[model samples]
Target: MPFAVLPAQICDVEPVYDVYFAAFKNEPIIEFLFPGGGDRKAHTAGTVQWWNHDRNGYTVKCVDTDTGKIVGMASWDIFWRPGEEGAWPKPDGAVWLEGEQRTKAEGVLVPLWEMHEKLFGKNRHVYLPTMAVDPDCQRRGAGRLLMQWGIDIAEKLGLAIYLESTEAGLPLYSRMGFERLTYVHMIHKAEVAGTEEDVEVPLMVKMPSKAKGMAFEDWAKRGYP
Candidate 1:
């Protein structure tokens, strides 16, 4: 059956966060963000609230056509037009992070701001900040499906796609026509329990073009974008 990719509704936030959290559970960045098995339910609620407001991003989920389950998800910051970006204000109850966790988030976002400006200053593009498939759902082309959704939109808008790729994601990104740019050290020594090393990820880009990632199955033969 053909894979199904759809706009993640607010109602799907819980499962979306479930896949995201589970996938990133062991990632160092996840440890820094929510030390010691943080509140997953609250994070899910916050995601719903935030989506109710206007944001320059999109979250999509890949469904298991056979079982009707959300097996993977991806969140993208779309900068399709020029001269976007201003204040960081959100609704009063829109924030999820707080206290130490909030600070850790800033530690990561702050450097990302600088890196983005330095690299693509004012350039229109799509940024895939986070994406994940359920551990049990790996190797099923869900990742590729979620990525193709972004690629399709980015190509249609004539925008380049950029992302900070984890070590495991490098090969897949490369297969998706993304070129490795440079390594970005967002933070060093997370200072969280059980994590005390520098945090760095590779910067990668896939300019809008005809090529698409044919990594899993026969997406190329299937005529995917």
Candidate 2:
């Protein structure tokens, strides 16, 4: 089926996260975050709250052109200058899941932040928090369509694109020219499971100013790199 990419609207938060939830529901993190499977209402509320005050965020969706149905979604936070991302205002996370369901989020989130800072520090870059294609739509190029949105921004702004990749996402990201830096192991001790659980996600980056097409631009040298 054919697909097209476009910016997502506020009304899209629900469906967008629907695809995301379905794509990641089986992941250990979700199970660890919500304990029992979470309903769409809670997931959508959290998604909305996350984007509410995030001024630097960019979100996009992929639609099945033939059927006009959404197939994938992606959200990224753009850091245009040094220290800007850190200083930016944020939404009150307390508005999301309440009680322990919310507090438990600190486990994966804190470590993820530590790893993020460790990787880029105060440098400007694009941070991909999450992206997902519906399970039925896998291997159909929807992922590439969604990713290219940020790639275009990163290339135009000359910033690096930083994202964590699952094992299944490796080949797609690798083919898109992202270099695998290292594995970031996020461990969350599950009080319910009574054991330590960890997810080994690959850290990847695509640095700008290295576009193959740039070789042919007016400012480029006579020959390609």
Candidate 3:
């Protein structure tokens, strides 16, 4: 079915949540986020509050025309402003290995603020966060559609899109023109019965607007910037 990329307005919050949960079904952080175990109602309420707080966040939902269902979703926002903390709540009470992970993850945001200054040099930028596609729709081109839409919007506005992603999603971003900025360790402390273990997350980056002449997917296959 043909996919349509539409601006995700306030009304689209619930649908966007569906895509988010579906995409992060296996992610441990998500499990921590919804400790009650995938309560759709709680998730919906949280999303509504988040959207209300950050009205500037832009979302694009990929809807399957035939089913008229939102199969994928991606969100971006203006770069980190001084003293402004972006959303994405910290994982709740850690389970053994997760306690320590939270501390490290919390610290990463500070460096992001520093990096924002270094990369854009005091000028505002755009940051991409929480991108996801339905489990059944994996590898079906929906992610690419949303990514291209993000690139188009960012370029038209003459802004740079920044994001930190997992190792699994690296190829997708690279294909869409994101470059690997660093492979820094993401430290997260999780506690299980008062014990600690650090969870390491790899970080990367890309400048889609700057890669206009290149084919991101091809470049991604070759591990090019």
Q: Order the numbered candidates by TM-score, best leading.
A: 1, 2, 3
TM-score for each prediction? 0.79, 0.79, 0.69
Supply the global lDDT for candidate 2.
0.73
Error of 1 at 207 (Å): 1.1
Q: What clash pairs does model 1 have?
A: none
Instruction: Please write out the lDDT profile of model 1 over residues 192-218, one tens digit for every residue.
Output: 323566656677878665445432123
Model 1 lDDT, residue 207, Cα:
65
Error in Å for residue 110 of model 3? 7.4
Task: Write the residue-wise lDDT of candidate 3 on 110-143 in tens digits.
Answer: 4444554444443445667678999988799998
lDDT of the candidates, in the order given: 0.72, 0.73, 0.64
Q: What are the per-model numbers of colliding residue pairs?
A: 0, 0, 20
> Which sequence of candidate numbers ranks them by lDDT, best first?
2, 1, 3
Model 3, which residues run further than 4 Å from truth? 79-122, 183-185, 189-199, 208-225
